[model samples]
Target: MKPVYVIANNIISPLGDTTEKNFSLLRQGVSSVRLHEAGNRSPIPFYASLFPETFWQHHHTTFTKFEYLLAQSVNKVLEQASVNPAHPKTGLILSSTKGNISLLEENAITPQLKAEISFTQSAKKIAKHFGFINTPVVISHACISGLVALITAKRMLEAGLYENVVVAGADIITRFILSGFQSFQAVSDAPCKPFDANRNGINLGEAAAAIVLSVHKPLNDAPILLAGGAVSNDANHISGPSRTGQELFFAISNAMQEGAVSAADIGFVSLHGTATVYNDDMESKAITLAELQQVPVNSIKGYYGHTLGAAGLLETVISICSLQENIMIPTKGYSTPGTAQQMNVCTVLQPIEQEACLKTASGFGGCNAAIVLKKQ
Candidate 1:
């Protein structure tokens, strides 16, 4: 098997356009989340991190908004890497829970445009735009889509199925989405607070993020290896995670096993930490069960809101930046420990000599995933 490395990455969020800009804003503890008035997005007022209309004005593309956002992220990443999308040895993978779902509300949906709703079709169009020859892969397994897509990319690179793979994930905020979460009472009225005593629910947001993985090392910086990844399911509930968190713990254990690292070797853990009551509690148990209770942990959901499919990829990119800068970003809206198990939830930005980091995510339908990254 070949060693896969992250060559470049890009994030299109309310905070900024590039990974560096987003990292800078996060370093300053700036959050784009705000209380949004009830309009076309939802019938009731809710807090969310939404991009201003001006953000779209900068991207001049003929593709639909969702497609264009994915392209914009990929374009930025391509600028940072030497990989060629037009080459035969390259592949593309897209992740999204909802793709162009907003179009269903339009007055008339033409047959041609209706195809955009299928995640695979949208991936094909985006892949063609970049001249990729292989059939594009699409993953839409709830919020875990992004992390699973990345795991697939790593396997592909290591198997030598492709020399370079562009993995991107995105989801737009729409009435359909807001209503679904609202029905479940999962929408927070204010900014979401992860791992806090007063935490309520998650704030939905929209974003597009892209990463380029390659077998070859970059010349400019130390290679960041996509060390190992593993995923598991609880088989307990569709919308809820395992009460024991044993499944998620299994994922963490399997991921570390694959990376050939022990819990003591992990510097920090980037958590799913969605501000919901059940999620934080489950994760707390998982971390403790894995014997990583003392490792500093932080979640960026408060900074960008729960961006659906984009959440995992976006958080991973930021955490990769954290590893490079030796800084751990604070949990933006956390003040007190709220989980049943005691864990080191970071509350302030601080520097540390991190050699490896763990990223974890759990979503709708009993799905759980964990991945490890290491500096070489």
Candidate 2:
């Protein structure tokens, strides 16, 4: 397979608008999650990370919040990449679990806007806005949507279908999403603490992240190579992950095998630590099963909360920066080991040279995905 490199990337989160700014905030141990007052639907205070009110002032448009995020992220990458958006050889992939789902609210309902509630329709609107010649590919695979989108982009590039692929993932915090998680009792009243002994539950967050992948090298610096990726299903339960970590372990092993790397070669692991009881446990067991227990691992959820569809890509971009800078940021809100397995969870900033890293994510519906990133 031909090498696919990450040529450019952008992140629109509460921490900042660009990748540099976000990484700086992360290194400072700053967190964007905060307590939010109950709105019309929610009756109790909840914790979440949300965009500042002034964030949309400059990019005002008729598009919904979700669309605005996607457009802004894509626009940022387009500004840095040399690919032409309208070129036939350039492809666009949008990843989101709920695109413009907020429009389903009673106040947002209107005859003309009704059709926009469809995820496909919302994606097409963004694609058309950017003048993309080909139909945009949409990935709505729950939380792993972003990683799956990247894996799909790699396959497309390897198949000679596109010279450049723009992958963007975004999800806004909505009352609908909040209520659903609340009903599941999966939301935490306090800011989430991943892999902490007293860790409670996940705190929802909103963000949009985009990355440009291509066979051509980047203009600024050497590109990070997407070496391998694999996805698996535990089929344990619709909403619950596998009680045993075997399925996720299979994904990790396959990803490493396809990348032509071994467990010992991975310098760090970007964990899918949602802070939920089952997720953190399952990931710890999976890491140990893969014989990567000693590798430094950290979860970015402490910094940005869980960005849903954007989480995977957002973390991947941050990992890429970590590889470029050779500094691994600490996993915020973790002070003690919380899992049964003794995996190395980064608690403080560590500086070291890293050649390759593993990024893994497990979402609802028993879906798990892993990808290997190698510094070029």
Candidate 3:
């Protein structure tokens, strides 16, 4: 298979708008999550990371908040690359669990815009805004949406279907999403502590991220390669993950095998640490099953919160930056061991010489995905 390289990328989060800015704040141990007062939609005070108020003032647009985020992220990448959006060989993939679902509230006021609430419709509109020629591909696989979208693009490129693929994912916090998680008792009142003894639950967040992949490498000093990816489902439960973590282990092992890497080769692990009791536990068991207990691991949930569909891609980009700078950011809010299986969780930002890292994510419906990224 032809190797796919990430030539350009961007992130629009509460911390910043560009990848460099975000990484700088991360290295300073700054977090975007904060306590937000309840609104008319959600009448409960909760913790989350929202885009700065000045963000919209700078990037003025008529699109909804969700649409603006997706468009802005993609626009940033296009600014740095020479790829033509209208080229037939170029493809667009949008990843989101709920695209403009918040617009449903406005249905009573403007029934004519009802069709725009569909995820597919929103995707098409975004593609048209960028003048993409081909139909946009949409991935809505819960939290794994971002990773699944990247994996899909890799397959498309390997099959000679597209020369360049742009994958963007974003999800904003809404009343519907907040209430649903609240009902599940999964919304933490305080900042989430992943792999911590006193951890409670997850704090929702909002962000959009994009990455451009191609067979040709860009003219840059640092280059990252997407070596392998794999997805698996345990069929254990709809809302709960596999109790034994075997299924997640399968996906991790397969991704490493396909990447021609081993447990000893991985420099660190970018975990899907939602800070939930079950999620952290399941991931630890899976890592132990894969015999990667000694590998350094960390989660960005405490910094960005859980951005739903955008979490995977956002963290992957940060991990790539970590590899380029040879520094590993610590898992924020983690004070002590919290999982049954012990693993090497980074407690502080450390500089080390490493080549490759594993990015893993598990979502609802027992879905799990893993991708191996190597620094070139």
Candidate 4:
């Protein structure tokens, strides 16, 4: 199979609007957590990593918050890759766990609401924006949505279905999501401290991110190739994470197998450290079982919070930026070691001229995913 290349990437999150600004703040160990005042009963006392609500109020109208943010991210990525929608061979793959439920609720409450927010509706809006004749595929696979979308794009290219594909994933924090995390006691009142001994829980945030994937494009100065990726289900529990590390073990081993690389060759592991007790414990156990001890690992949840569906793509963009700049971002709020694992979680900022990076995510519905990226 031909190598899949990440030609370009862009993101919109609470940390900052542009990719460069977010990465700059990440390198500085800045935390974006702030008090959430929705004036409604929330499970969390105060939430971290929230976007300026004014941006949404001013920039979007008439559509669901998900649609507006998704469109904005897609436009930015297209502009970066110089891909014109007028091109016939291009395709789109959109991933989101919450498919406009914010609007779904709005329509549900008001009987006059014409249509509920659906995958087809979002696809039509995005396709109309690009004037594309084909319908875009919308995928919802819990938190692994973004990386799964990337895998879909690679398959399309390998099948000779399209010369290039645009992969986008987005989800906004809403009353529904906030309540669910609170139900799990996973919403932290304080800023998230991933991999820290004192780490409490995750902070919720909203984000939209997009990337351009191609097979024949010339390798750019910092071409981050999609070496390998896999999504698997633990089927262990509906909400509780598995402590045996069975699923994550499969994901890591599969990624190495597909990339033809050893666990030791992996420069860093961008872990799915959610700052929750179960998630943190399970992820640590998995890494240890894989024998990836001493591999530097970290999570960006402290910076952007958990962006849900968009977390995978947004964090991948940050990972790519780290590779290009030769700087590894510190785990923003980590103050101490949480578990008795041998893996080297990034406690302080460091620099490395890395050639490859591994990104991982595990979410609700017993889903887990991992991907390998290489610097050109």
Candidate 5:
């Protein structure tokens, strides 16, 4: 298989827009969550950790939310990678669970807005923003969408479909999302405390992230190799998490097998610790079944809140920076352990030197994905 290298990465998250400031603050274990705007929440009293709307206004050349985020993140990653998309050999992959959903809502209510925000229109706008003559393939796989995009990009690169692949994932927190999560009782009034005994559900947030993959040698960032990854379906429940963790175990095992690594070789596990009781328990079971219970695990939700579809990309970007800097941020708000399971969840922030990290994420559609990354 052709090696898929993460040549460059960038994130626009609740903590900060640039990777540098965010990484420093993350290392310090500081959280950016604040009470949500008065009218923006449900009875659950949602919290929002967001970059200023004004901060992205200048970058958002289009009125569509997804296009704006996709363009902004893509621009930053491309600039850092020094990859000129003006070349024809580059391919773009856009990922989001709710692509243009906000716009669709508005358009449905206001026909005049319909002309601006269709899904295809949003994808086209992003492609045009990067000056790419080729249309980009858009993937919407719920919360695991970003990781799936990265996996897809790697496959395409290995197949010689493109020399350089621009993979981007972005999503905005909207009233629709707030109400939906609230309907499921998944929104927490307090800042989320992943893996904590008294932990509530997730705190929704918005973020956009972009990652560049290339077959050629990367510059100096010590780009993590996208060694291998796998996606699996639980098929156990529609909304409830699988207690057996059968699907998650399959995903972890497949990823390990593809990368030719054992569970013991994984330095750390970037868990899908969403803090929900069932989710946390299921994840713990999965880790044990994979025989990776001893691996240190942490989640970034405490810092950025949960960015839903954008979480995988945002977390992967953070993981890459942590690998480069050699520090691991704590799973903020985790005071007491919640999972009555085997794995030792790394609650407190700790610094460590490691060469590989396995990032995992699961989402609404019974979808679970795991990606193993080796330090460059």
Candidate 6:
């Protein structure tokens, strides 16, 4: 299989706009998470990373908030990477769990708005906005959608289906999502504390991220390779993950094997540490099972909350910043290791000496996915 390099990336998150800008803020331990008022999106106030309601008012657009974020992310990445969206060898992939689901709040959903609710239609509009030549592929496999999109792009590149792929993911928290999590009793009252003993639940956040993957070497940053990726299902529960984390371990093992790397070679691990009790514990078991107990692990959920479909991609983008800078961002709000299996969770910004890193995610339906990145 051919090697796929992350040529250019953009993250339009609450932290910052560009990758470098976000990384700079992260290095200083700055976070965007804050207490947001209930407004029309929830019955109660919640702690989450959100742009102000009027953040986009200056930029009038016909696109919905979700599509606007996606377009902004893509436009920046394309401009930075100089990738031709209209190239026949280039493909576009959009991933999200709830695209335009917020339209339900309207008094009456118009036919046009109803049509825009479909993921494919949203992708079509985003593609047309950028003059993309191919029908964009959509991945909505829960929270792992972003990583799954990257994996899919890698496969497409290796199969010679595309020379370059723009993998973008965007998800905005809405009343539907907030109520569902609250119904599950999973919404945290405070800033999420991943892997912390006092951790309670998760904070929902929204973000959009885009990364350009290509067969050619990048002209700018360190040559980061999306070397290996694997996805798995534990069939444990519809919402709960594998009790033993064996399924996630399988994905980690398979990913490393395919990447031609081993646990000993990894520098740090970007986690799906949603700050939820079970999630932190399950990931601990999975990492230990894979014999990565010593690898420094961190999560950005404390910075951006759980970004849902965009979580995987958003975290990956930030972690890529970590790899580029040879520094690891701490798992914000984690003051203790609360998982049953024990994990080496980073509590502060630390220097990193290695180049290979692993990123993992587990979502609803007992699904788990992992991918390895190597800097050459």
**Which regions of candidate 4 deviate over 4 angstroms?**
41-44, 60-62, 109-114
Per-candidate TM vs. native?
Answer: 0.97, 0.97, 0.97, 0.94, 0.94, 0.98
- Give the per-residue lDDT of model 4 (tens digit) for 86-105: 67778899999886776644
| Per-prediction CA RMSD (Å) | 1.3, 1.4, 1.4, 1.9, 2.0, 1.2
**Quality of model 3 by C-alpha lDDT:** 0.90
Off by over 4 Å in 3: 58-62, 109-111
Clashes of each: 0, 0, 0, 2, 0, 0
Per-residue lDDT of 20-74 in model 5, one digit per residue for the tens?
8778888787888888666644444568776676766575444566677777788
For model 3, name the residue pairs that clash: none
| Candidate models: Cα lDDT each | 0.90, 0.90, 0.90, 0.81, 0.81, 0.90
True lDDT of residue 137, candidate 1: 95
Model 3 lDDT tens row, 1-376: 9888998889999998899999999999999999999894479899999876677775554577788899999999888777899999999999998878887765564655677677787788789999999999999999999999999998899899999999999999888888889999998889999999888999999999999999887677778889889999989989999999899999999999988898888999999999999999999999999999999999999999999989889999998898888999999999999897998999899975669999999999999999999977
Model 4 scores worst on lDDT over the 10 consecutive residues at 105-114
List the candidate 5 regions with Cα displacement exceeding 4 Å.
40-44, 56-61, 109-116
Per residue, candidate 2 scores C-alpha lDDT tens digits across 1-376 of 8999999999989989999999999989899998888786478999889987788786665678888899999999999896798998999999998888787774666777778787778778888898999999999999999999999999999999999999999999888998999999999878888998889899989999999999987665656899999999999999999888999999999999999898778889999999999999999999989999999999999888899999999999999999888899899889878886888999998975668999999999999999999977
In candidate 6, clashing pairs total: 0
RMSD score of candidate 5 (Å): 2.0
Extract clashing residue pairs from model 4. 33-49, 197-336
